[model samples]
Target: MDIIRIEQLEIFAYHGCNEEEKRDGQKFYVDANLYTDVMTPGLSDDLEDTVNYAKACKFINKFLTENRFDLIEAVAEQTTRALLKEFPKITKVDFTINKPNAPIKLPFGNVAVSVSREWHKAYLSIGSNIGDKEGYLNQAVDMLYDDENCKVGAISKFIQTKPYGPVEQDDFLNGCVEIETLYSPQELLKAVNAIEAAANRTREIHWGPRTLDVDIVLYDDEIVADSNLFIPHREMHKREFVLEPLVQIAPYAINPISKKTAEQLLDELRGQSENVNSGCAGCQGCAMRK
Candidate 1:
């Protein structure tokens, strides 16, 4: 990735731990590496094709002066997020803040903190089996797009599917969405759960009916199997409801565990279903067997 470097941009801001430091304020130094493609602008000699360093510097200065925090870590984190949000073309940010006037009562050159953040690709499965099913699904999509940290990409058309569990509920409207997000897997899960709560989802039974259901299907080929979350969801390959809509939005997306594409999984599932209906011997080895 091409980078634009800004070194030691000094700013006077009110950020410190003590009452005197907070009240008096001090000068802070910032260094940033803005990652993006500069080849186009270089070749065409057009300022519009690349990030405007002057504007970014001005924004950085203004941001530091406006926000008050006790630690340099907060300054770096908040500044990087704001910079990424303001500059859509920049994919990543490497930020550092320097505090030379820290009150340690001893000789010290400087105290600093650095952080790096970037955007990641993630896929989600959404379903609604109760009232206003389609509307709930659409609203979920809108809410994801509304978040500044997330950029909605491709979305599949909704398809009706029978309930997965033993619950005697109505059919579900299922779909998939592709998005680019700056949030980690845990953070993304929290955001989606908040959206589900807004749609009045209830969790009375396992795999039971819901007003709105959101599951993380994939996240940049990452494999996470914890108590609360799992990526490339546990039962995605076996469920036609998930594979069908997932294939529409991301046909070539591979499952990290099985290393199979969405289309391949769907085809294998359908083939097994056919064999079961035809009373073939392979039914014993079918995905639906157990």
Candidate 2:
């Protein structure tokens, strides 16, 4: 990653906690580091291949001047998000807002807030086994697409698969979704849970019928294991429904823990299923020929 630095770009903005400070705008200095690949521009010497610092500076100036916030922290956060969105080439940003005229009774040199933000690639597994199964899955996808912090990418074809777990249930419509999001793993979990709730998903019985089920299968090759959530989904490798559609869209996606690609995992799972008894305890769907 290459960095394009914007240092101490001064701007007068009305951003502060006090009313007087908002009324009498103060001078704010902004520093930003835009992270992107500059190799193409370096070799070609074409301005189009690189992020234009001039344009970026102007955008920062305009954004800061136009927006009114109560705190410099908000300024830094919003500015970082805006820069990432405005310049598609920049994948990450480190931003700082310096306020020298802060209303401190005692002498103070400066007050500043700095923030780092970047987009993360995440894979989500979506399924529905109840009424309006397809509708519920589509609604989940639409909810993710509607979120400004998330960019929905390739989606796998929906496939019907037998239910998992001991509880009897109807077949499920399962698929995977690829996305680039600004939310952290926990935040993304919250977002997906909200989407499921919107579809009237219930949790009465384990692996029982439900309107919608959204699971975070993978997030940027990250390994997360917590009480509430697990990345690479704890049982994804054993569940054909997850790997089947996941392979369709992200065949090369690697599991951080297993260090195996989606294709490799799926192949291994299928090979094991071939030798095992047809009647599997966990997921009968795997035993059924696709």
lDDT of 2 at 253: 96
lDDT (Cα atoms) of all candidates against the true structure: 0.93, 0.92
Q: Report the C-alpha lDDT of model 1 over 61-155, residue by residue, as the tens digit.
A: 99999999988889998899999989988899999999999888999999999999888899999999999999999999999989998999999
lDDT of 2 by residue, 1-290 (tens): 89999999999989988999889998999899999988999999999999999999999999999999997888998889888888999999999999998999998899999999999999999999899999998999999989989999999999999999898889999999999998989999999999999988889888889999999999998889899999979999999999999999999999999999999999999977875766555556755755
Deviation from native of the Cα of residue 284 in model 2, angstroms: 27
Worst ten in a row by lDDT for model 1:
281-290
- Stretches of model 1 off by over 4 angstroms after superposition: 281-290
Could you tell me which 10 consecutive residues in candidate 2 have the lowest summed lDDT? 278-287
The TM-scores, one per candidate, come to: 0.93, 0.90
Number of backbone collisions per candidate? 0, 0
Report the Cα lDDT for candidate 2. Answer: 0.92
Best by lDDT: 1
In candidate 2, position 163 carries an lDDT of 93
